[model samples]
Target: MKSALIILALSFIATFSNAQKKVLPVTNVTTGKEIYAKHCMTCHQVDGVGAQNMIPPLIKTDYVLGDKKRLIKIILNGLKGDLDVNGDMYSGEMPSQALLKDDEIAAALTYVRKSFGNSASAVTIKDVRRVRAANKTISK
Candidate 1:
């Protein structure tokens, strides 16, 4: 009976620790929402549906769910001129968000990738850093 109690206690502790590990992603999501509200929501809108004929929507578009590096580059380098998404065309300029920290960018993107009917992996700060570094090489 004493051994059984110890086993139960261990199991509880292990489960609790594992649950704690899951919270980090939730925290990131929360932070991303806040950042998006401040920096992106105006153009992308609260529902992630962008303005028609101007700003593009974030709703499961290839730009939001496509290559991680390319997505990151858009934030870092900004996009301009004609671009097509889901049969729609947007020629408006997207200003660079390179001013945001790497982690901020990651969280914002991770939130985007997981939101608006999208289901994708989270973007990590490390991924942002690597992409940012690579972009520098291409520019020069």
Candidate 2:
């Protein structure tokens, strides 16, 4: 009976391990990077360092480190205000990214958040959709 119980436990563990591995669907970081290069890298720069006193830098920027909700809004709707990033005042007009799909925004944001020495949770399409929806409702 004890041997049977041990075998059952082992089987359960094996199943759990397999399930964990299967949880993550295939992610194409290359595609995400390509999108960023075409859309974002021009302003944000390849290394995420924006022009000094002009475009705000994404690497170690307070905008990325502060509130996640605010960042989502900025990505979706664009930002136009005076933002102090790393003790430097950055006031610029960032065009709205509403044209991009939610999934594209998620991928770009996720790439930005993960790259350039910044580590954070992955941004999901659902997150982008929720924020965009909330913005629309608030504007109306």
Candidate 3:
């Protein structure tokens, strides 16, 4: 009976520990730089200067360094219409990148915010998850 009790306790402890372990999503793409290169470099350009009067620049722009939630949504849902960036009117449409996993989105955005002469906070995985959940954005 004592042997059985010890086994049961050990089993419970093992189960609890496994449950507590955090599992981050797996992807072939690692690092924010890689994600940015694959997903964002074409539009924003290698230096993030973007096309003149066309795609908006990511250089110290309010949109990039602004509210984290809005930025996350932009990546998830895409954006249309014109934006007045640093007193310049830029017009373009950004297609939805919702297919990116939460970690991917967070990584790319964090990279953008930190790159292109912009110094903003890193977008956390928790932040992405919360925003994704709030907006019902699903990742493919």
Candidate 4:
């Protein structure tokens, strides 16, 4: 009886050990360009040139390459009223994208800074986190 029990237990262990492990599908990696496309492309356009007399072009603009904090705020808080860009005034209203995660915001901003003929520093996740925290404080 003891030998039979031991054999049963060993077989059970062997059955489990030889069982096939679940193979998980690889997760899709989200890129900065992809994020931008999902969020900003409709307004900014594919070339980042924006709409004439409406959405301001992001190319070679201070708004794109100047201050990282302000740029981040624009995305988080949105912008309205009149906006001047390199002597052109854009009356478009930008909706807030506060729902985006820190990493996503950082990636989108980094993509903008580097694209559309603008060469600027990458906006890190830490930078977005800091600004988002400050925004919360200011709002309250």
Please report, in order, the local distance difference test score of every candidate based on alpha carbons. 0.91, 0.81, 0.85, 0.85
Report how far residue 129 has shifted in candidate 1, in Å.
0.3
Instruction: Report the C-alpha lDDT of model 1 over 12-34, residue by residue, as the tens digit.
Output: 99999999986544338889999
lDDT of 1: 0.91
TM-scores across all candidates?
0.79, 0.77, 0.77, 0.78
Ten contiguous residues minimizing lDDT sum, candidate 1:
21-30
User: Which prediction has the highest TM-score against the true structure?
Assistant: 1
How close to the true structure is residue 17 of candidate 3, measured as C-alpha lDDT? 81
Local error of candidate 1 at residue 75 (angstroms)? 0.5
Off by over 4 Å in 3: 1-22, 25-30, 137-140
Error of 1 at 62 (Å): 0.6
Poorest stretch of ten by lDDT in candidate 3: 21-30
lDDT of 4 by residue, 1-140 (tens): 99999999999988776663322211113467888899999998987989999888878898899999999999999999998999998887999999988888888888888887788888888899999999998986
Candidate 4 regions with alpha-carbon error over 4 angstroms: 1-30
lDDT of 3 at 101: 87
- Taking the candidates one at a time, how many backbone clashes does each contain? 0, 0, 0, 0
lDDT of 3 by residue, 56-95 (tens): 8899888899999999999989998988988899778999
